[model samples]
Target: MGVKSDIINFPVSSCLSPTDKSLEFDRDFRIRHYAGDVVYSVVGFIDKNKDTLFQDFKRLLYNSSNPVLKCMWPEGKLRINEVTKRPLTAATLFKNSMIMLVENLACKEPYYVRCIKPNEVKSPLLFEQERCRHQVEYLGLLENVRVRRAGFAYRQTYPRFLQRYLPHINHS
Candidate 1:
């Protein structure tokens, strides 16, 4: 099979005239068209040339003094101002939160639970050898076994270890 070549055509200009009521001209003669959404940008609708539309949108959404926005979400407006004041990206916020979580976990006695999928078919007795091997390797069970065989895999001070394991055994 072979494809046929055909020329595609597009309109050279918009159908609406400058005097059309749908289009409005500001003091600077910048055209602002009224789409279904009341939101306006300095850039024209078709071209969307404004680079700072996101920032402008954010400002509109989080305008603390805007009566409609304040009425719609009082708490959101307050929080938005706090969030906008800080120059933090989503990645930075996520990294900071993860670091806090890790620090918190380090200070506490952590527990790990390992889960394995027995088989793809969901049969109780079906033990797939290859799948089990892959899971074991991925979970580092082999490394854990090697560490245990060599020596203590984990270390802690005698007093701290004793305190953790045997609460009744006073160090006095």
Candidate 2:
């Protein structure tokens, strides 16, 4: 607070003027976003801003005897003192989980098969050879099969494959 010009709090913007004399928004602050400027009251979340609320929730859920919650909040296994200097936000946690899921699935070598309807009108017992053949030709299913057969080996993106299995190799 003693550092010169190191402002502790933002000053009320000159652009923000209250319409009613009875109302006062002294504690509120104006934030400039790409869409527009908006006023926010810091009164409610000031204390919450400093606390590791999500981390606490993760730890609480981790302590539960239920297997599902313990599985979801893996970081909860870490003691309160072991958490990083800044707690990771919910979005960060979600992103990390998604990355891991993608990496794990990439190792499975799943193939995409597009099922084409026999006809447009939902008629049963209809076999459209021309339509099915056209789809297979255009979708390069034949070429894919030829290449796969020629190679006769599992193929995956190297970086993702390495990242997925590296931990297992190191640990074992």
Candidate 3:
């Protein structure tokens, strides 16, 4: 029998980093909890798929220097608040982005998404109390979906790459 091509074999682009203008004072990255008032502008649609959620996800997956994107793994569970009405698991977020792809591809059904540690890219600046504050406020730390068995150790396709770029974690 001949091997068949995967229907989901979509080419991905590079993940988009936040612009300097977008970076908020005192934030590491721009993230709003589900309870937050902000709409959290995930690009719904962009023709040819550029800048859209699907492309962003695909790029975030492939372009990362981190190893997690190269393979798949099981992630822990999450629970929704019901009040905020948002997903508790990072997989849920991934699945939603995939759904956008599927729907755009004219597929009626949703595909399952599994969570791995979120890609932990650097915050894009050296630590300065003031500059870093704006950067932090603009971009709070992204959550780590995959936690290592040991509290200090981390698991993913890659290890410690993000930490390499981040400012020294103050142990004091």
Q: Rate the local accuracy (lDDT) of all candidates.
A: 0.51, 0.66, 0.38
Instruction: Give TM per candidate.
Output: 0.37, 0.33, 0.16
Error of 3 at 156 (Å): 3.5
Candidate 1 — number of clashing residue pairs?
0
The global Cα lDDT (0 to 1) of model 2 is 0.66
Stretches off by above 4 angstroms in model 2 are: 1-53, 65-68, 109-172
Q: How close to the true structure is residue 52 of candidate 3, measured as C-alpha lDDT?
A: 26
lDDT-based ranking, best first? 2, 1, 3
Clashes per candidate, residues 3 or more apart or on different chains: 0, 0, 22
TM-score (C-alpha) between model 1 and the true structure: 0.37
User: Candidate 2, clashing residue pairs?
Assistant: none
User: Which of the predicted structures, 1 or 2, would earn the higher TM-score when compared with the native?
Assistant: 1
**lDDT winner among the candidates?**
2
Tens digit per residue, CA lDDT, model 3, 48-163: 23322233344455556667653321221112222233312344445545656567778444443432222234444433465444444444323222233335544333347665
Q: Could you tell me which 10 consecutive residues in candidate 3 have the lowest summed lDDT?
A: 72-81
Arranged by TM-score, best first: 1, 2, 3
Q: List the residue pairs that clash in candidate 1.
A: none
Which has the higher TM-score value, candidate number 2 or candidate number 3?
Answer: 2
